[model samples]
Target: MIHVAIIGQGLVALHFEVGLEKLKNNEIPDYGVPLRNWLPYKYDDIEIVASYDVDESKVGKTVYELAKRDYPGNHIPGSLKDIVVSRGIHLNSMKGLPFKARGREEDKGIEAAINELVDEWRSLNIDVLINIMTTEPVEPVGNAGEIERRALNGDLTASQTYAYAATLYSAKYRPVAFVNAIPSPIANDPGFIKLCSERRCVVFGDDGSTGATPFTADLLEHMYERNRKVIDIAQFNIGGNTDFLALNLPERNIMKKKTKSAIVEDILGYDAPNYIRPTGYLEPLGDKKFVAMIVEYYSFGEFKDEFYVVMRINDSPALAGLLVDLSRIGRIALDRQAYGSIYEVNAFYMKRPGPPGSKAVSKYHAFQGLLNWLGISDPRMQQARR
Candidate 1:
């Protein structure tokens, strides 16, 4: 009966609620109550409870109300009728680095927002703060001290400070895990990583949303296994959410581009000249993600072949399953006193996984390892191992 609190109430948060519901209903004999259910395992059990968001429309709304208004996808099956949405400290959080917003004013004071949000979180006794916001590149390690000073001095906004304070608080608070579902620098920062180690709190991620790229990696790997020469690979993605909107700025995407490029390059063991960044964002598509990739290869002597793959997926639901798994795993890690990176779980669950110099493992292998670690024995994971 681990009580969970979600920090963001966007599409990703909605997906997490869906995953929590599935876990709740996954009943097992003598397990007392299912750990994964959306509702608390019991009435007043307070398992998956409360959500916090800064959106004016979402604040003070019930989870059910917010779900109906913003995410009509119904990613989470049941109506979250009882779950209440509380006002989260805004901390003036921004989605991507070199933050760019189409309409919003930039003068929203950050220090006030963050202080208020932190106060709210502390008051709520939140055990877990899942950051499912968009990707943002953290400053290089050397610049962290100056950034920290700026955040503390009210010179930085809530969004910027979140990366630093969240790391500090996570390390200071035992039994509380900070899970980053986005490709933000908080999870990768050396200071934060060390703090997590000291506090024995779990810090997971860099990116593991293998929606299209990982699938591409798998396809390329299979081709390479047959001695196929991959001459070029190009991936183009378009979406209409904050994740897509964040990429419009190059600064936010520096690490993301590096990470995605490396994943493909490592899989093929060759440099791909055809890689492309996420191109444009179309608002009509909302949270749906469309990825089109073209792979060109020369097989046999003087024979040229090309393969194109198009993947369209509901980004929220696609990642929902993984987040649910990660949240539950975070709880388990806390229970077992797991500390630092939680490599076994992180590698299987995150995108740019492992410590520097550690061999990169496939998503399938990581998923299998997670299932095994959780004693889930899910057939999918077992099949993945095979």
Candidate 2:
């Protein structure tokens, strides 16, 4: 059995736990679930052996406890009883984020907590580390002088905390793959990427899922195939959770905005009147996200053609299966002696993938590449394309 250890106890981690369970069962009964059915793999050989989270309410809890108590929004159709949660080192990564804690003493500084957690990771024999934590935007420390000053003072942020984790693991472990499930700079930063390459640990992603971009791209491709004249397109996103809150803060949204916008412009080869950014944060929506897209073009003489589409999905579960697949794939890469970033998996599975200004490839192609490299065929990938 392949032992997998997830790093964060957030929504993504819960989704992964569910997927791992399904894989263990060896049969996927269709539940008529919509977006949840899109995950492409179910491997009976995989198991989630351990998990870590700094939240006091979540620590020392079982997976079933986490599902029942912390994640009431999950609708996975079964009870989760066997999974267990262990205490995680609290890094500066959680600072300034809005979260609920059980005790007052738990809401203290992060440095010590993070150091202890790092030590635990070293000793636990974890196979893979999925960095599913929420990422904040890197603030401009003014100029080179200010950046140097902050670097000297060791001002800790989410980005720095992640880099530190990756660097530390690279030094002591047997090539642990780090999956950046959120839009954090650690995966994209040149220094961090170089560190992972040098240390031989694989790194993938700076973003997770695309709720509407894929469909929008398909529509644009169809129009192009029909010799239709495309004029403009606009996309809007709204949510009611931490992602929304992060988007509302300019400091946390710069990379996210750029990543989303690039997905359209790169595919279409031209800029549309793309209003692609988070519009508002609503309380009633919780972790649900609603995206509205409008595409307008001039086709026949004097005729204006417009296409409008709206998507509503639970953000966490939508990407959960994919993340689980990624973590498993990361382990596969390590077992096969693969190093650096796993580009094929990331390109096909991630939202804003690769360096900026690069074209997005189909997930089918990426999966095929991975299968060929690893010598494992996926039954789902062999089936007819959706």
Candidate 3:
């Protein structure tokens, strides 16, 4: 069983818990989940052992109560009824958020807070730590020593503090996989990657690729393979979630835009004139987000063609489904002694995968790489056809 700890007990975490309980009870709708369930373990094998959050409203509540509060009238399973939301590092993660952030700073500083988290996770036997925290505006640290210094001096972001805590926890206990589900640079940061490697922890992600970004990557790959000369592309998302609310800040928006736009150059081998970002937030839209895109390119005989795509998707659940894959992959990587970041898994599932300058492969190629890395012969793989 994979015992997991959550760093953010928000909608994504709630949806993830609901999905897990539903999967165990065979209550999942016939429509199917987005995850490729060909992993070594089933979704039910994952156990939510503990959770952390900085919101005062969410801090002391049990996971069940929080889920009910976030998604009122929704059914929360008994499996998650007992897990309480613990306090985590706040550190400007909730700066532009509606609620006032409450961190563990009153009782302890950064180092002590990390030590507290490590001890708690060690006692809880957390195998994986999934960070669904809000995106924080941060620049990558130069090295492990610098990050350690910053973390000790209370100079790191909330996500980085959580990562540092995960590393310390791993060093004291067995390997724990860390799946960073936001735009913060835990896995992509060279400093955190080095620390995770030294501590024998598996790290996955800079940002989870769920909706527009992955779709754009697939389409771009298709265009490149067909020898289409792409002229320009524009893609943006308008959402009503708290995440989008937070992204209204310029700094937070830049962190997200960086991840979304990184795929263009790596996939096409050159940068095209492109506009990709979270354009706005509409509270009335709720969790469903409006995604629109326009890709213009040249075909044979210098013919110009434009492709317009518009889609409305439930953003949180889509990403929450990916967390299932990431959590299990984390455990599998740990068991295999695949310390540090798993590029094969990250490339397929993340936006700006691997360290800061890693090239982005096509989704198909990434999937094949993941399957090969896991030694799983999926019949759908193009390599299998070969």
Candidate 4:
């Protein structure tokens, strides 16, 4: 079995845990899972063995209990009860927001905190660690030595702490993969990449591409392929989730902007005047976020054309589906000992695919590349050819 550990027991984590169990039990169809049965590891082979969180309300609870609280009308899988939310290294990730939170680092110190978590992971035989944490502001530690130093000295953020511990776990026990589903720059940081490469582990991410960003990417691709001169682009997302609340802060908000805005230049081969990021948070809207984007581009003969898109995206569940694919892929990478970030894996799923200067292509191209990496052909194309 692919034993999985979640870094944050938030809505996305809850959704992933519950959804995976339901998929295993044949209670729910794998509608959102992108690769589905095509992967070498089946859905039932994945298990949620552990979860970590800093919130007082979540720490002592079972995944089942949290699921029931967060998803009132939905059916939560009983398998979730076996997994309890454990305290993690907080580093004030939820400090500005309203969650009474604390971390293991607070009680045991950073060294002990990291060692303890690695020891726990060793005990659990965790193969993959999925980080769906609150968006925290962090810059790339360009120097690999600095990453090691900060991790040892406790100058890192919460997500970085967890990532550092995962590296330690890999060094001591076995190979592991870390999927950073938030905008924490784990995959993008040159230092982290070098460390992971040396340590014999894999890390995928820098903010997942779930909503308007991917759509904008594909649209930008269309314009570029047709040789359309793009004038300007403006896209923004608003939601009621805790992530949105966290993004309301300028520091956290800029991280999302950096991840989202990179696509325009990467896809179009030039920078476009763009304002793309999470705009606001309304509690009543909950996980279903509103997205609005407008693109103005020049067609042939200098004809100006514009298009506007409005969507109500269920922010958490969309990302939750992505975690399913990431989990299995992480497990797959562990077998191959693919130390460091896989650009093909990250390009399709991550808003900012790592290794520093990697370009963000449209999901259409990324998907084809992803399938090539997986050594799987598109079945529909085969059928069409036949």
Candidate 5:
């Protein structure tokens, strides 16, 4: 079984905890999970061992309480009551945002806080640690040594510190995977990748590709395949989730902008003028978010064509489903001793697959690459061939 620990006990993490339990209990079908049931590991093999958060109100709450309070629909599993949201490393990730948050580092030292986290994971035997923290402004530290230094000094972001703690846990106990399901540059940071590789830990990250991001990616692939000269692209998302509130801050907003905009150049082999990022927050919308996009391109005979899309997606659960697959895949990576940031897994699930300076590919191609890496075939494709 893959024991999972969540770094940010937010909407996405809550959905994963509740939804995963239901999926294992056969109460729900795996709809949004891209590689569902195809990998060696099944939903039954996944478990939420622990969860962490820094919000003053959320620190000591059980997953069941959080879900019952925020999770839509009903039937939050009693199994979730077993896991409690503990205090996490803050590092001012929520600064400028309207939330009262504090980390153990505030009371203890950074070294102590990180050591404590490692101890908790060791006790829980966490195989995968998912970093789905609110978007924090951070840049890549290219040197692994620098990352280690900053981690000890509390100079790194919360996501980086958790990643460092995961590395420590891997080094002292067993190999593990740190699945970064946010926009922080853990996988994109070469230093973190090297650190994980040295410590025998795998990292899959940079940003979870859910809602409109993946759709726009595949759409770009369609245009590229048809040899359509894309003139420009504009896309935006407005949501009521805490993440959207966090992105309202300009610094946090830029992080999403960078991840969203990178796909254009990577997929088309040329840069296109584009505007893509979280545009606004509407509280009444709750977990469901409004997404809109416009892609203008040139066709034959110098004709200009345009594509417009508007959608409302349940953002958190969509990502939560992806986490189910990622949790199982994390165990598979450990079994294979595939340490460091894995590009194949990240390419399909992440907004910017990492190991620094890696080219982002279309989801269609990334899916094939993911399957190729696992040495497996899509069941539907297999049935069709038969």
Candidate 6:
């Protein structure tokens, strides 16, 4: 069984908690969860051992209460009612946001904060640390020296501190994986990458690829494969979730835009004039975000073809499903002693995967690649062939 610890107790984490509850009870839903074999392990193989959050309202509340409060209709397992939320480091993650976030670091020093988390991981036997925190406006620390320097001064972001704590915990105790789900650049940052490798902890992320981003990536790869000259592309998502609310800050939004826009140049072999980003926050939309895209490319004989489409999807559940895959894969990587980031898994599930500059592949190809890395066969693909 994979024991998981989460950094943020937001919607994605809650959805993940609820989903696991459903799986444990054998009450599988017909839709929502897209991945079938989290492979070699089923959903029931996963467990939420501990969780952290900076929201004062959510702190001290059990995972069950948090899930039920947000999604009252869903039946959360009684088991989760025992898991209480712990205080987390906030850093600048709450800047420009409406709500005030509190971190334990305010009362305790940085070393104490790290030690506390390390103690928690050891006690909880956390095999994987999932970071689903809100997007932060980070200044992009590029090297290990800078990471250490900033961390000493308490200038590091919340995600960075959690990652550092995970690394320390891994080195002193057992192996662990830090699955980053936001655009804080932990996996992509050279500093953290080297630290994870040296410390024997696996890392995956930079950003979780869900909804509009992955779809656009596949579409871009299709255009490239078809030898179509892409003139330009525009894709954006408007959501009501706290993540989108956090992105309303220009600096934070730019970080997200960088991840969303990185795929075009990598996939197409050259950069095209494009605008791909999270455009706005519409609170009424809630977790279901409105996504719109327009791709204009040159077809045969310089004929311009424009493709426009729009749709709405629940952003949290898609990410939660991907987290499930990452958590299981992380445990598998730990078993194999595959320290550092796994590009194969990242390419499939993350928008801007770690080890930087890796080209984005189509969703189908990425899935096969991920399965290959895990040394497992795709049962769904096999049945389709038959």
Q: What TM-score does each of the candidates earn?
A: 0.77, 0.78, 0.96, 0.98, 0.98, 0.96
Write candidate 4's Cα lDDT for 1-386 as tens digits.
99999998898987888888888888889987889899989987888899999999999899889988986348787778899999988888897998899998888899988999999999999999999989998888787788778987999888987888888889889999999999999999888888888887899998889988888899999999999999998888889989999999999999999999999999999998989988898998999999988989999899999999999988888898999999999988888888899999999999999978999999999999999998999999899999
Screening candidate 4 with a backbone cut-off below 3 angstroms (N, C-alpha, C), the clashing residue pairs are none
For residues 248-330, could you state the per-residue lDDT of candidate 6 as single tens digits? Answer: 88988998998899989988898999999999999999999998999999998999998998999998988887787788888
Error of 2 at 354 (Å): 2.6
How well does model 3 score by local distance difference test?
0.86
Quote the positional error of residue 97 for candidate 1 in Å: 13
Q: Residue 32 in candidate 3 has what lDDT?
A: 28
Instruction: Give candidate 2 regions above 4 Å deviation.
Output: 26-42, 73-97, 100-115, 139-156, 223-229, 300-303, 355-357, 362-386
Candidate 2 backbone overlaps, count: 2
- Per-residue lDDT over 1-386 for candidate 1, one digit per residue giving the tens place of the 0 to 100 score: 55667766778787567545644565222121222343212322335576766566676777777777776654445547767876554433554433322212224455555555555556555566577655655553424466667766655433345545554555444356677666655555565566556666677766655577567656766776778888888888889887788777777766567656666666667676866567778988887888998988888895999988887877776666666556666666777777656666666656666443343455666656765666666655469999
What lDDT, from 0 to 1, does candidate 4 have?
Answer: 0.90
Model 5: colliding residue pairs: none
| Ten residues in sequence with the least summed lDDT for candidate 5 | 32-41
lDDT of 6 at 115: 89
Q: Which stretches of candidate 5 lie over 4 Å from their true place?
A: none
Tens-place lDDT digits, model 2, residues 1-386: 45566767876677667755664564454232222323333455456667766666687778777776656444452535665777554434455567643321144444454455556666766566776666566632323234324433446454455445655666766567777777765455555556666777777776775576556656766666676766877888888866677677776667577666666555556666667777788978877889998888888785898988988977777677666567567777777667666666666666666432336644444556656665665667568564
Q: Flag regions of model 4 displaced more than 4 Å.
A: none
Q: What is the C-alpha local distance difference test score of each model?
A: 0.62, 0.62, 0.86, 0.90, 0.90, 0.86
Best by lDDT: 5
RMSD per candidate (Å) reads 5.6, 5.0, 1.9, 0.9, 1.0, 1.6
Q: What CA RMSD would candidate 3 show?
A: 1.9
Instruction: Point out where model 6 deviates above 4 Å.
Output: 30-35, 380-386
Number of the candidate with higher lDDT, 4 or 6: 4
